[model samples]
Target: MRRKRAAGEPQWFFRRLVAIGVIGFAAWRLMMLESAPDTRVNETIAWGWILLMATVVLGYLGFASAQDIVAIFATRSGTPYAALDDPTDPPERPSEPPRNFAG
Candidate 1:
């Protein structure tokens, strides 16, 4: 039995499917070019694949960096609750004064 997908699972699955399709198409095209007589065509295809992969990697990195920046700013804009002391839990004070070290 197939389990039900979560809220965003469908979108995730669709993205994976599209990625797989693109990679498969590229691989197929490359394989088809293998029998071509011209070496330039093969090199071009190889270079295109390399560029495409690089672009994808760079794009992912850029997205992650942007997310990090947003998260940092979000945290900075929020009030720091840790610094605030709770009224219910009052701080303890020393009852006696400190004695001289010489004594």
Candidate 2:
């Protein structure tokens, strides 16, 4: 009953898994640093780590949103994969003459 996945599906899933693991690890490290009184982690280093993790998370979100925007525009305009069908051939032009709007 399940549908077949595309060629890159497994790799995509693996990448997502790795990303989640990294983010989770970062969160766990932050929590540990905050809770442990014995550990002498520098405040500046902690702030830097927080900034780095925030950048990674924000960059991922931004990239995903940008991809979604592109997909939406592609669907609205025309088939996004039209070029993939036949890369060598140029796109077909409409037979009708161009319309004027100067009037």
- RMSD per candidate (Å) reads 13.1, 13.5
Runs in model 1 deviating more than 4 A are 1-21, 77-103
Name the runs in model 2 displaced over 4 angstroms.
1-12, 35-41, 77-103
Q: Count the backbone clashes (under 3 Å) in each candidate.
A: 0, 0
Candidate 1: tens digits of C-alpha lDDT, residues 1-103: 9655432222345545655666677777778777877787678887797677557556655765666566557667343222444499678886998777985
TM-score of each: 0.44, 0.47
Q: Please give the CA lDDT of all the candidate structures.
A: 0.61, 0.64
Model 1 TM: 0.44
Q: Model 2 residue 61 lDDT?
A: 73
Question: Against the true structure, whose lDDT is highest?
Answer: 2
